[model samples]
Target: MRPRHPRDVLVGYDGSDNARLALQEAIFIAQTSNARMTVVSVVPDVAATINAVWLAGGDPAQLSREMRIEVAATLEEAIEQIPEDVPVTKVLGQGHAGPVLVEQIDRIGCDLVVVGTRGRGAMRALLLGSVTEYLVRHSSVPVVVVPPPERLRDDLA
Candidate 1:
């Protein structure tokens, strides 16, 4: 059997600390394998945001614009950290994180998918934030789930 070497890598990033760690690991993998890296951030349907903005006495359009700007800024910051030599692309996805990432994995012809887990607890995991779980169960290629660093886990505990 031959060891797998990815030619294209896709990472799920949401600007969280854990996501940053995942991105770092993805970068390392892409660098080692000479793969193109795609960083994706999924923004779910804006209906909830619109409702919240309306309830908060703000213009929904204005809030939506601000959110887009914030998302762009966050992605830009992440992109800046990537080295100059690595071929990279950024994608802004709509809808749920798990489904969107899977779609991107196929669309980008990626052989590996990287995502971060909060490492809150197995019990809690059953209830919320199942992006990593979903990918592990459904990804056709390979999924790498990066948990928070040991120090961060200790601090959270």
Candidate 2:
């Protein structure tokens, strides 16, 4: 069976292995389907009071700048993997992960969205919630959830 082609595809990237796989899949789909791709990374915003409390001695401005730099690097790595023939755009967003992704989906008018899920980290979940789950439930467009690589899967026999 053939999968439907997406006109404009949006992928959420975080520089994780799962995200790398998702980017690879999205690129292949974009290439075969003659679709354009957009890659987005989120730089979560911590409130000033929270930063002062949790960050302690860390400089807020420096931390924000570093986050932007990391986001740019992630985009650059994804861009390098993409074939030259495929049309692609990159965006670095600020704020919470789920809402930012949802906002980008609407703002970009993408027909499809791709995201990657990570291992269950209780601390991470308690802090950031689940972006993948939120997108699967709330996104107006279709979504593809890419799991960890085969080598990383412990269930395979």
Cα error, residue 39 of model 1, in Å, equals 0.7
Candidate maximizing TM-score: 1
Write candidate 1's Cα lDDT for 46-132 as tens digits.
888799989999899887777777777778878888899899999988778899999998888999998887756645643325888
Question: For model 1, what is the C-alpha lDDT against the true structure?
Answer: 0.84
Cand. 2 TM to true fold: 0.84
Candidate 1, poorest ten consecutive residues by summed lDDT:
120-129
**Residue 65 displacement (Å), model 1:** 1.2
Off by over 4 Å in 1: 125-128, 155-157
Could you tell me how far off, in angstroms, the CA of residue 144 lies in candidate 2 after the best superposition? 0.8
Query: How far out, in Å, is residue 67 in model 1?
Result: 1.2
* Worst window of 10 by summed lDDT in candidate 2: 120-129
lDDT of 2 by residue, 1-63 (tens): 986789989998888898998899899889989999999988878677456855587677777
Against the true structure, what is each candidate's TM-score? Answer: 0.88, 0.84
lDDT of 2 at 80: 87
Candidate 2: regions farther than 4 A off: 1-4, 48-55, 121-129, 155-157
